[model samples]
Target: MLDDITELNENTTFVEEAKTIDEEDLYPFPTSEDEPTTKRFLGMTPAQLFVISIEFFFMVLIFGVFFMIVTERMTIPF
Candidate 1:
């Protein structure tokens, strides 16, 4: 590690200026002013709808496994 650090120190292009984000940084999505924008449901955006769909999928998967265990495993005698 010490030899590696020494070799890295010999290189002059290691340092660089860090770029800072400002308020002017906007998302790359395009929105047109002339098009009528549909209102969000309960203030939920499309991204939130996608996330909710993923959550529901996982919930169904977990419950399916849980119900299968209750039905299949509980039938065994103690």
Candidate 2:
């Protein structure tokens, strides 16, 4: 075990650290203004738009049924 430990230590090598460090180099910020824009309306993803459509469908369904009842188009049997 001791011989194996010494052999491992002898095989290891050290790397020198950088001589100079810059703040800008650490964190790079892009300065380009020509980034591509998404084609989705109001920046909503397809899944989000689908969920909104489903909610709108239910809203219209409920309101339509209520309107029919108010106008005597549909009657309650009870």
Pick the TM-score winner.
2
Give stretches of model 2 more than 4 Å off: 1-37
Worst 10-residue lDDT window for candidate 1 reads 14-23
lDDT digits (tens) for residues 1-78 of candidate 1: 234654564434433211333324543454575445887776789999999999999999989878877889535356
Q: Any idea what lDDT model 2 has? A: 0.70
Q: For residues 1-78, could you state the per-residue lDDT of candidate 2 as single tens digits?
A: 234544554433433122244646765774344444556777889999999999999999999999999999998779
Best by lDDT: 2
- Model 2: weakest 10-residue lDDT segment is 11-20
lDDT of 1 at 76: 38
TM-scores of the models, in the order given: 0.43, 0.52
Instruction: Report how far residue 65 has shifted in candidate 2, in Å.
Output: 0.2
